[model samples]
Target: MLQPPGALPIRVLVVEDNRDICDNIAAYLEKHNFILDFAYDGISAMHLAVTHAFDVIVLDLTLPGMDGLHFCQKLRTEAKLQTPLLMLTARDTLDDKIKGFEVGADDYLVKPFALQELHVRLHALFKRSNGKAENVLTVGDLTLNKSTLQVHRSGQRIDITPTCMKLLQRLMEVSPSVVTRDTLETLLWADEQPDGDALRSHMYKLRQAIDRSFEQPLIHTVHRIGYRIAEDM
Candidate 1:
């Protein structure tokens, strides 16, 4: 579905046996608006992974019934899911990480790690799994030409401010996935927060240029969360 980034909650399958670790992960991710499903064992994790489509999966190495290596192997070979998987393990040895990768794990994270780091890693894996970077990013009729730094919708050119162009670039780059307001704000304004509702003002201008004249509005606001560029609301 190309949900590389999201205004929608990033669906994550958390496979871990440790209650404390699961609790911590849940708390942290939920605060960031991530939708999480927990599995205490490898069998349960495999079932959930196979059934649901997730942006990423956090798997623990030491698991009852299946184990992370076996689970990763079965997911790739048996279920045939190419979902991004981040291996979580207490074992930080080179061999342990290599073994994980050999079995189809995309990335690795050691235990006793920062929650923020985990979040960042998951975002990276999700983007990589979908479409890392393309010169032209297209969502339906709307397109952003990175090389020339231009925006177009249905053959019509969109002349916008540099700030608005940056906004459109970002939104189109992560099309189908809603980009959160906080994310957009950070991208535009960085740590120095805008004086007052500057993002909203800019977004209004963007919508006018990109959507107001079009029959089908390509830019959409995702309520209190953020904005996205998609054919569908």
Candidate 2:
């Protein structure tokens, strides 16, 4: 898969009870620069999925404690997580695949699959999910394409890390309105924020990317309140 320069590694959760299978998947995925978290059962998976942000989920259909179908249902209907889910199962029947889809699985793969195939499918799912939002956000001379994850200012392309992209997206989405520090922190880290000035550090980098070289600054600090992006610096 093609990643933007300095882009963050894809975050993935693998929910499978089989230790051997999880190990194999982890080894292969890590080799490809993916950051993976493991959950041996659906219960723990649900907790992780609810509390943290993930780019995708690789769910095993026969997971212990809650099973994949129920876990998918809970995430979609109750927890409201829209993270792409790829179901892994030993059953290859048409009914089984239909059930998986009905329960909110974005893709499915039968057991004894090749690791290469798994990687391909995961890349496809990530691409599909990102392409869902076709809207391009603009604030002043800065423009961000949500579908392509491209950012340009004054008609020049700007390289940005994924975190910076997210921060810019949020600020541009609510241009001229202050986005609270708490809200930006939640957007960046979910429930796992790091200590002391981390948000400031990121905001500084974002400002540098979008404002440092430009003639007029589009991002403004709201003085202990938050930050806002507008035409007037």
lDDT of each: 0.84, 0.86
Would you list the clashing residue pairs of candidate 1? 6-178, 7-178
Best by TM-score: 2
The regions of model 1 sitting more than 4 angstroms off are 1-6, 132-233
- 1-233: candidate 2 lDDT, tens digit per residue: 55666766888999999999989998898978689999999988987886577889999988789999999998886554679999999989999999999989999999999999998898888878877844798887789997789999989999998999888887886677777786678778877889898999999999899999978888889998889999985
lDDT per residue (tens digit) for residues 79-164 in model 1: 55678999999999999999999999999999889999998899778767657546787989888887798888889988899999
User: Which residue runs of candidate 2 sit more than 4 Å off their true CA positions?
Assistant: 1-5, 133-233
Best by lDDT: 2
Q: How accurate is candidate 2 locally (lDDT)?
A: 0.86
TM-score on alpha carbons, each prediction: 0.55, 0.59
Tell me how far candidate 1 lies from the true structure as C-alpha RMSD in angstroms.
Answer: 13.7
